[model samples]
Target: MTDTTQPNTATDARPPAAPRRRRRGGAKTSPDARVAPPPQPGARPPRKPSPVLERLFALYPRLFGARFVPLKLGVYEDLLARHPEDFSPEELKLAMGQHARSTRYLESVAAGHPRHDLDGNAVAPVAPEHVHHAILELHRRRHPRTPADAQAGLNARLVARVARAIEASGLPHHDYAARVRSRDASANAVVDEALITLAAQAAKREALLRAFEASGRGEPEFAEMYGIPLDEVRRSLQQARAARTPAT
Candidate 1:
């Protein structure tokens, strides 16, 4: 203390901490600090549609046009398969458009109708008899020797007969312009024949129900196998029973 060494006081203080070490090379930069160019104003992104939506859109035009008849028929078949209830007038119109009336006629013929006679007794329409007879004749000519051939032939004949009768009665060509205009009367003839054939098939089912009842069998175990309703089957069965009973 007595030597008074002028103690390096003011200039030394650790050299200002070496200016924070200058970050080794320079101050660190963040990725966001870099500027990016902006996109052009008019550029648009491509539009895409789902595959299912695209398929439905593609089908719309055909589905709404006259060509939709086959589609409607397919839907009818599906409805008959899944649910045996008859389609309402509005539903038929929506599905068949111009052909609604014809479709309804066919359905009625296939299902048969009940009318009241003079004394207020119910009179049932005879199911497509002519058509059934014609089918039997055809099968007799074609498959004369098959096993259980008579019964099978009878059933086939009945189916065809019903289909033919309905076709003739309904006159489906009245609604189909192409059929009406075709030079081949044979086409219309064939269509009429077909209606009877279908009606006969329905009648054959009724006949089967009768066979079951005559044999003391319970209501047909598989009456609704074709997707027809159990109640409708029962109704047909009742009709068959009444027809067989002969009025007192």
Candidate 2:
């Protein structure tokens, strides 16, 4: 005898798995969780403007008048933000002076750039383009376009140094070295004139010293006679003697 038994289908059956939903905002998480990369170490932050820049902003009115400041200050600030960090305050001022002497600026002056309105203000704001041109020109000046430009600058510096050395030479001295070093006009004749002046000064100093010694170091009388400062008489005499002394 055989018995027919119906197996339970519910116990044998499994429901379909629900579809996997993606993450709302980010990538789906993988079975092996990913670790975020660490931030790079030792990254230098952007540099800020030097303190001299602040002073430059303060001096703008004196450097460039209201007429020149036509654009909103923010515009100039934006341009300055692009100003090279390597440029120093002195260099910036130098660039500005160079710009002022430019033929374009001079032509504008001839055309009355400094003209004023009835309200005691500039007729109009200075052309922003003009200012920008000056900025570019200044950068060019700093960079020096041609070989001659750099040489010219060096020559100017050498000439100035020569002039200073000649002026400071208190005794008869031949600065042939300076004449040779100066790339510009030789100041050799200047040395001759300076020597003459020094000789005269020496004569005067010697007379004053003789009078002082004769008067038993009387400061007031010697100073009155020479018409020199009484307070500086001792110092002047000492300096004069030192100048005449040859260096060992």
Score candidate 1 by TM-score against the native.
0.23
Output the worst ten-in-a-row residue range by lDDT, candidate 2.
177-186
Give the Cα lDDT of each candidate: 0.45, 0.49
What lDDT tens digits, residue by residue, belong to model 2 across residues 72-190?
32333343455557445465565545545654444444332433322235555433333323333344454554666544433333333333433343322454333332322223333
- Who wins the TM-score comparison? 2
Q: Compared with the true structure, what per-residue lDDT tens digits does model 1 show for residues 88-125? A: 43554354443323333233333443332222244454
Off by over 4 Å in 1: 1-186, 220-229, 238-248
RMSD of each: 21.7, 26.0
**Residue-level error in angstroms, candidate 1, position 11:** 43
Q: Quick one: best lDDT, which candidate?
A: 2
